[model samples]
Target chain A: MGALSWAALSLPAKPPGLAKASLDRLGESGVAHPVTAVLLNYRGYDTLLEVGVLLLALAGAWSLGRGEQPAENPQSRPLLLSLLRVLLPMLLLAAGHLLWIGAFAPGGAFQGGALLGGALVLLILGGLARRALKRERCLRAGLALGVLVFAGIAAVTMALTGGLLQYPPGAGGALILVIETAAMVSIGLALGLLYLGGQPPEGARRSLLATPPDHA
Target chain B: MIWRSFDWFLLLAIVGLGWRSLNDRDLFRAVIQFIAFGLLAAVAWVRLRAPDVALAEAAVGSGLTGALLLSALARMRRREQQAVPPRTEASE
Candidate 1:
């Protein structure tokens, strides 16, 4: 019965509300990707708040308890290390490409950041990267950078344009790109930290696996 | 017709998996089933023509969430083992 009802429903001839109008003028919004335009321009304030929520979630997770200490000088299997050496670069490249294309295609800051987060988790699992309390300042800055940049841009644009988050004419694209790059970095770092679940111990061990033979 | 049938099958699979995951007795098995459900949900998102949602579901939903769940489960298991030894030794 539920399936039948779902099947019976038909898509509207045109999108409801302002979405159609927004879609029509999306290109002029300085983003080729309509979704990006909607997310970062038409409704940018929401996205900014969403990034804040991600940071808030991290804070909550951290408050739950300190995570178990990671092993010191942890060693990965030579094969796994070699595989990661090859894989990590490709993942980084893909993340970069996703961020770059987000302005014109289906990719965006969130997707790119998530991929980067996945890569960071892989590195952590492989013992190539360790969370360290000493690095908390840097990590916190990275996590907050997106929201800080976004709010700063909005405030500056508001002063210039007399409207919140309204980018000046002819500069919308550049500003959005700047915000997206900052957002991508913050999102990536925030997600990575969230996966770590709690404050890392001081001086956590770094990966000490020997370099693969073929690389030498 | 074939596409419609495929969608139906996909929907049923999602529902079945969700039910199984929720009702599974073992925490580890439940977590694994939940991850499987997440992957299927990604497929369903793709079928709904929302690639962005599908990507998020696949990456954050299945990948990261699954990792978090498994780690939490491991910690719980370790605590249980620690608790059991003391109690069992006392009883013996």
Candidate 2:
């Protein structure tokens, strides 16, 4: 029931002690990013709430899985597709580097992993999404297993640390890395799973949804 | 600023993909376009100093979304296949 509420602090050039501490950790002076510490440091209650919000969103997505399917459309040329095919992966990897750099600079796990996942999404949209799924039961197991393992770890942390998710100050960076990484995988899996369930057939959901009921 | 050169190109791709996604002749392409838009948006995030948000955008926005969309496509394909039953000659 820990709601992780992040403190609102101006990422201006100079600020209060908390801001300074945060920047020092990232090895930067500016504080443009939301100080997760304020949320994580002092607001254990809110972090749990944030997890609840995520859970709600996940629930909503699952609820939306009743629509028909969409028909295919023509896409851009082969050359452009080829170029993107080459470039997207590189962009994602760079994002990961940025995340690691954020430990002593700016850019952290969330940003880095997002970029990587984004690239994967791009590849999938380009008509390659199917290959990744493989229709294998093991893949499904992996998806659920990753989530379970993360949850188990977090629970263990709560037991050992006397808080829902407090890592030692020394291991702060490592903790963030672990959480964000797991988040990336789980989020990607969830998104992909939703798509599989929610898309409508040839705008069937849209058309049906767009047209209201008759005045009987 | 390595992102500079790729910025405009990705932007164009996003717009093109998004527009096509929303109003293409085929419903399926639209879903794909939406996924592309998410990826490009991630690039924009990387440039904009919000790695965390970008990660959310990419994975949640595109990855899972694309998978969901593809499944939807498969379902539609199944429906289509069902509609056109093979070998329906007059039963003598």
Candidate 3:
């Protein structure tokens, strides 16, 4: 019965003309990639909400329980450490390149941010970013920065153009870049934290008391 | 004709990997299959002309998800090892 019903249902031969409409108005966003323009300009609200949801997920994870500290001693793996030393800078450069080329290519904040998170995960695995991660305040700020900046832009643009996330004339590209940059940072931190699985260890407080004060 | 054949092969690989990932008895092997499935699916997305989705699928779908699953498995194994033996004598 189910197979017969499924076979009886005929789908449309063509999709709705949403893509045509998007392409027709693509110049307003000033980006060569229609996907990028749609994501950052035409329907930025979705991305904003997505970032917020990621932040909420991290928050919920932190609230639920603490992540177990990695059992392996990173110092034992000299080869891995050396490899990371060579790989880290390349990852950073590539991530930045991806973000920049997003204006004209298939890369963007999410792709770049994933690379950044991968870098963070490498540092964690190598025990390189322990001190930096210890700065919980700084980490929290980075996690929230994307959503805050995106929401702020929405409010500002709403006031300027009288519509939420509607960019003022000639400033759409620049505004999108700003939002993407901030979102990249936040997304990277959030993904890394999600992998970490729970609240970071508080043992860093004791270490801080024993050592001299240092900036993040 | 060759390209058409390749697409069919790709489709079969994707479906086979997905099926194996879901039904495999070994957790680790299942996760590996899942990652491979994600990678192939990303390729399929590219073949369909959605490079943006392809990039995301490769990065977040396969890479990050594979790492997360491996770590979660490790944690589960550790917990299971710690919990297997009961401590009855000390409780009184």
Q: What tens digits encode model 2's per-residue C-alpha lDDT throughout A119-199?
A: 654555565554455443443454454355456656877887776666554665556556545554554444434444532
Model 1 / residue A74 / CA error / Å: 3.9
In candidate 2 chain A, where is summed lDDT lowest over 10 consecutive residues? A198-207
Instruction: Flag regions of model 2 displaced more than 4 Å.
Output: A1-52, A66-77, A134-150, A191-216, B1-92
Candidate 2, position A209, lDDT: 41
TM-score, ranked from best to worst: 3, 1, 2
lDDT of each: 0.83, 0.56, 0.88
**Which runs in model 1 stand beyond 4 Å of their true positions?**
A1-17, A69-73, A131-133, A204-216, B86-92
- Among all candidates shown, the one with the greatest lDDT: 3
Q: What is the per-candidate TM-score for chain B? A: 0.90, 0.70, 0.92
Clashing pairs in 1: none
lDDT of 2 at A141: 53
Which wins on DockQ, candidate 1 or candidate 3? 3
Model 2: per-residue Cα lDDT at residue A83:
71
- What's model 1's lDDT at A2? 77
Better of 1 and 2 by DockQ: 1
Cα error, residue B26 of model 3, in Å, equals 0.9
Per-residue lDDT of model 3, residues B1-92, tens digit only = 99999999999999999999999999999999999999999999999999988988898889888888887898899888877665443454
**How would you encode candidate 1's per-residue C-alpha lDDT over B1-92 as one tens digit per residue?**
99999999999999999999999998899999999999999999989888878887888899888988887787778779889988988999
